[model samples]
Target: MKHLSILVPDDRSGPNTVACIAGTYHAFTEANKYYGTLGRKPVFKMELVGLSKRSELVNGMLMIQPQASISTIRKTDLIIIPALGGEFLEKNFVDEKVSAWLRGQYKKGAEIACMCTGAYMLAATDLLNGKSCSVHWKSAESFHQLFPEVQLKIEKLITDEEGIYTNGGGYSFLNLLIYLIGKYYDRQTAVYCSKVLQVEIDRQTQSDFAIFSGQKKHGDDMIRKAQEYMEHNYDRKISVDELSKELAFGRRTFDRRFIKATGNTPAEYLQRLKIESAKKALESTPKTVNEIMYEVGYSDAKAFREVFRKITGISPLAYKNKYNREAAELLFMNDAN
Candidate 1:
């Protein structure tokens, strides 16, 4: 049986923290039971490992007592890091013991999986330096600032490279658990777990769910001004030359500053801003695709649809059908009429 060590971080304390830990444990244990029904031995010998025997989180609301301490586990087949709660601050939150333990486990041939902002903890070990990771889109800016070497694939729901795996933000960790079940067990087992847990399997991207809020935390005054201008005037055609001249900056300098601050070029930023606006209109208004396109300053139908697909991984009508509840109801009433 594979020994799975689910690390209960000493510093993490919150409802989210509790959910991930309990949820992961439940999923794996349930998978084991499913295996037993098929006349097979349990696949994983799972245990909660920590720096200490017991730890209280969220102001003592949740107390966790680990089955094994970090020093006690000389070898493990897998390490699962649950999502951390709260803001990922600039303060040094890297636990040396945990980091060392992770590295030792990896060297000892253990695969690592980090759920949501647990990627932050994995990145601290420097194992994810050159690896691609999927984090919550909301934390993308902060994660970029902290771990620039790690390639952040915000649109992806899961990232698996080498022995390290990562999942995107929120309750999407359930998807990762399902994925791991498919990998470690059989596909039939994974499907069974999904149905039992009420989670959809094979969800590959979080793009459609991502809300594009421009990254402006880089502290460049001119770039901030440019971002505000683009956001305020996203409903009209925006020329890069006009922004440059207005800021009295040369084209190259303007581009550099904008990219440095926002992690997107001037054009990409504008496109995202327009798409975000378009998404809002699609969700709330009974607007046609062309109407939303024109409302967001796009005159070309084909160009707008292409860009929408490129950014959001879905077409305009599909997005509306999925999100526009009022429009759907109205259409139903019209059909009745």
Candidate 2:
């Protein structure tokens, strides 16, 4: 059987952390049950490994007892890091023993999988330096600020590179679990698990769920005012020249400051703001695509559709169908009647 170590870090205590651990454990065990039904032996010998034999968490309300400590585990085929909560500071909760153990395991040819913010721990080891990984969209800015060396792909639901895997935020880790099941077990088994677990198979991106609020944490007062103007006047045509003149800065200097502060060019920032407004209208109002396009300052239908798809990974109509509150209410009423 393949050895699977689910490392329960010292600070791994949160609402999502517990669910990720329990959910992943159940998924793997259920996969083994499916294998047994087919007259095949189980694949994984799973255990909760920790720094110590017992770790109290969540202010001592919960206690996790590991079957083995990292010191005792000589080798494992796979290591799974559960999602962490509270904060993303590396120095705050990182265990040096865990980091060394992870690096040692990787050198010994063990595959690593980090679920959601667990990527923070993995990244702390410097293994993800210069590597592409995904994290929760809400944590993207913080992760970027801390680990500028690691390529953060917030739009991706899962990233697999050279045997290191990272998944996106929230319950989306279920998709990653399904993906591993497909890889280690079989496609048929993965499909069975997807059906049993009610998880969508082959999900690739989380962009549709991400809300793009313009980054405004920098200390550029002029850029902040410009951003506020663009946000308030998103439905109007905005020009960089006009903004620069209004802010009393030269065009080139204004562009440089805007990019430095917001990590997006003025045009790109405006487009994102318009698209975000369009997304809101699509979700809440019974508006046609053209109506929303015009409402968000887009005159060309093709350009609007392309920008929407480029940023959100879905078409306008699809977004509406999935999120339209009016359509949902109408369907509910029809079913009731």
Candidate 3:
């Protein structure tokens, strides 16, 4: 049997660790039971792994004793890092012991996986310096600012490369777990777990769920004014060049400062702003697509749809249908009719 080690969180991390560990442990053990029904021996020998044998979870309410310490486990087939809480990325809980041990295990041939914000600890190992990975969209900006070398693919629900795996926010970790189940076992085992786990097996993108509130923390007053202008005047067809001239900065300089401050070009910021507005209208208003498009300064149908899809990874009508309360009632009423 291959050893499956699910690494427990440190004392400084969040309570999210509790649920993440439980979910991961349950899925693998439940898969073993499924295998028993098929007359095959259990393939995974599972353990709750951590730096110490007994690690106290924070907030003084819970405690977890790992079945194996990383020091005791010389080698394992896989390492699972649950979603880390607190300021792991900010270095408040940078465990050099854990990071070094992870690299050592990888060199000895262990596949690694991180669920949601656990990507922080994975990156701490320098394993993801140049690799592509996904995490919850809410943390995308902070992760990018801290680890610019990493290719942050927050739009993706899951990313896999060179035996390392990561997934998007919260319960989406279930999808990552199912993915591993499939890879470790067989297709049937993965499928069986999917049905029992109530997880959709084909969810590919987290983009549709993303809410883009543009980065605005940078203290450049001119750039901030430019952002406010674009936001307040989203209905107007504005130009960065004209705005730059008005703000007494060259267009190129304005673009540079904007990118440095917001991590997006002036054009990208404008597009996101427009799409956000269109998203709100699509979700709440009974307005036509053309009306909303024109309302957001888009006159051409193709251009509007293209920008919408580019920013949101879904077409306008699709977003509306997925989220609109009015659309849901209309569908139900049509069925009744």
Residue pairs in collision within model 3? 14-85
Local accuracy of candidate 3 as per-residue lDDT tens digits, 186-213: 8899999999989999688888888888
Which portions of model 1 show Cα errors greater than 4 Å?
248-250, 330-337
Q: Which ten residues in a row have the lowest lDDT in candidate 2?
A: 85-94
Q: Give the Å shift of residue 250 in candidate 2.
A: 7.5
| Per-model root-mean-square deviation over C-alphas | 2.1, 2.6, 2.2
Instruction: List the global CA lDDT of all models.
Output: 0.91, 0.89, 0.86
Query: Clashing residue pairs, candidate 2?
Result: none
Clashes of 1: 0
Model 3: how far residue 85 lies from native, Å: 2.0
Q: Which candidate wins on TM-score?
A: 1
Error of 2 at 91 (Å): 4.8
| Candidate 1's TM-score | 0.94
lDDT by residue (tens digit), candidate 2, 263-293: 6789989999999999999998998889999
Could you tell me how far off, in angstroms, the CA of residue 239 lies in candidate 2 after the best superposition? 2.7
Ranking by TM-score: 1, 3, 2
